[model samples]
Target: MRFWLLCGAALAGTMVADTASADTLREALLQAYNVNPTLTGARARQRAIDEGVPIAKAEARPLVDSDVTFQQNYRGISPFQDNGRSISAGATASYPIYAGGRIKNSIRAADTRVSAGQADLLATEGAVFTETVAAYMDVIRDVSIVELNQNQVKVLETNLQASRDRFDVGDLTRTDVAQSEARLSDARSRLTVAESTLTTSRENYRRLVGLLPGMLEPPPPLPTLPQTPNEAVRIALDNNANLKASEENAKAAGYDVRTARASRLPSLSASTGVSYTDYLGTLDNVTGSAAGLNPKDAFTDSFFGLRARMPLYQGGGPAARIRQAQALQGQALEQVIEVERLVIADARSAFGRYMAALETIESSQQAVAANRLALEGTRAENSVGTRNVLDVLNAEQELLNSQVLLVTARREAYVAGFALLNAMGQAEMRDLGLDGGTLYDPIVNYKRVRNKAWDWSDDPAPTTQATRTATPEEDPRAQGPVTPPSN
Candidate 1:
């Protein structure tokens, strides 16, 4: 009896260790947000767009430039003279008084493009979040499968031992013993496959999150879905990033048209410049007398001028540009329409998948319950000699399969919920109820770094520690012999 108690305690300890070693889903998600390459690339692209704001604002500011000219003139009259040497220096300042409405429209277009860039970054982030959640869930499901299969193998091993004992006593036939062994072998094979699958799933999760896989706490329960697909479609159409980007694009295209049309109007500007030159030379008259020129022969000139340029005729160039801009505007409008259609389709598909996953969860739960009962009954019949060991093995296999299916169904349901949120462009970390208190915010960190919030520029680079580094247990490329399973 003490031996049995010790075994029970050992089993419980193993279970506790396994649970403690697992990483939670939220931790995996945070890691993924921090290290995901796709997201990092998108953020860099957005910063590039942010620079456009300063560039566009620069257009309305004044421009200043200077030029210097050195010239040696030979009049063929004085080869021995300085030959009217002159050094000219000039500076000019100009400011755009007006370009009709072209400059303003162009700036507005740039602003809208910045908005589109932001939307694109958000969309990419949403995509990465969705994928990370899916992969994390996959690892969870695979781990559960491995656990279930391990349990099944344990039960089969126990049954096989019982069958062998009974066969030695002539209470069970050789056939029964053979059947029990076959079931145990099959269970062992399944356990091996489950372990392999769990390893692969862990690697996938690690790749996305840049960390080792750990025990995952089950996600919180989801809210009920919308009652109608139309409701979902409406929400998505209003909030989808792709749709928002398209709308911004259309606005930018309209601004382009404005810019093109403004080209036909007059542009006004003001300019000022100052110039100085010194000329030293001797002029020879036709009477052959040499005359010395005054050093003050060079004078400084300063001028300020206002000018207006009106487009007259360009041989159809202005009209052609206007027509091209109009065409592009039309194309943008059509793109908006196309995006609307796609948004609706995506909403419908996600809603359907969510509903299907829900149904599967229900059916799978029922199957698990039914299979458990069937296996229990088969074991009782076998004890009474009314059923053979093969019947029991078959029932056990069915139960194991049903448990795996149920785990998969639950995972699918969770993923489907997130997918619906993604389709609606509402799958942010905050929406997942994972906000507040050290939650990793990519945008916040990006802004902090970009705006120099922390003064990290002054920090020294980190040095490696002298402590020993730990090696991961599950290396896919290792070629050593496989270890036998612990009983």
Candidate 2:
């Protein structure tokens, strides 16, 4: 029966899938950075933003249009008198010679908005990476806790069996046996909870990493950190994506104000047009010219001229718009200040929490060692009849508690370190070395579309899904493991 029980346990263990080639955190991050659906959507949105520059540029270009007309008229009541018929065609072209700087300022505003969009994209990328890291760490933490709980259950089972044998031999009382059974039951209950937590963490991992987690490798050492919170805040102020975006937005709003003011100034434009009409033998002159379809008979006219207009007044609409834009620009500038303060506060808070977690790790390690020794001493004393079974059980529980604390402390230390990196705005691909070949450079797309008046290319725009050429030697997978930057 004992042999069969052992075989049953072995078979149960085999039910879990083998994961010999455990996935590394770096590999998970690379997968998320490269193909996460949220990131792909953001890239597509940025490509749409790149079109705004070209749309604004259209204002300074020419406009051309054409029209054709045909007409027939009947003369008063002479049956054989000639009928009047005419056909006409014409084309007109208009070019804006000057628009009092409105066109230029509009283009400037659009260019600034594109810059702001790129910064927003950067912020989104950072957020996705942060979530992926959190999910990866959660799985690792919960798995370790589950294993620890399982071991505790096994240890309690052994203690319970020993207490039962002792009670039968009169070495331990019924109360001692009852205590052991109670502790074993409690350990089993905790193990069930730990298993549930691990399952939840794995589900979150699947959501972020695009696959259910296999066995995950332990994370490597943390990245280098600043020596002080002040230094971290300084870095955040300079590099935070949200801060940069707000500054760009403020500049765009300033240009908007300029564009509104220019609306009140004089504007100039030039236009040219030509028209032709032919009455194939109208009633008025049909017989006089027997009009051999000659070139001189068709009525034609052409004219070209420049015109200027100044807006004297229009119920103060332009002035009201200018004021509105100026107010919005002020609001944008204040938002920059708000974002800077928020970044600094987060940096300092994460820095403090990380330092506390490091200290807890050291303290918990010492506690675990001390509690382990105390448990051993208590058990030996009970074997020699100097201590009771209850004392031994209490010491064992203390040691288990200390072990759990140590595990939690280590997890907190690693997670807090990453939080600090995120607060400082350094949690991006280039900083983390996750940017493989063919980095998505928004500037490339902006330049491609900004000066274009029309899209005549057979290929689509340079979107995230567009085909890109890469060098034969550039193997993206060979880029090597992503490591933290040196301080």
Question: Best lDDT goes to which candidate?
Answer: 2
Could you give candidate 1's per-residue lDDT for residues 1-487 as a string of tens digits? 0111121121111122254565665666666665676776776676666555445556666778889897766647776644556677899999898988887887788778778877777777678878888887788788778888888889988998999999999999999899888888988898899999989887777667776677775554555556678998988887888889889989999999998888899999999999986553422322234564333446699999999999898788878999999999899999999988988998898888888887987887788889889999998998998988899888988887777777887778778777777778786554555432564434453343333322235335643322212244656435566788999
lDDT of 2 by residue, 440-478 (tens): 787898888888876464245554632223334676745
Record all residue pairs in model 2 with backbone atoms less than 3 Å apart, i.e. clashing. none
Best candidate according to TM-score: 2
lDDT of each: 0.74, 0.79
Off by over 4 Å in 1: 1-22, 73-84, 161-186, 279-291, 313-316, 430-433, 436-487
Candidate 1: clashing pairs of residues: 22-214, 22-215, 23-214, 23-215
Error of 2 at 423 (Å): 2.3
- As a TM-score, model 2 comes out at 0.82
TM-score of the candidate numbered 1? 0.78
Worst 10 residues of 1 by lDDT: 1-10
After the best TM-score superposition of candidate 1, give how far the Cα of residue 64 lies from its true spot, in angstroms: 1.3
Clashes of each: 4, 0
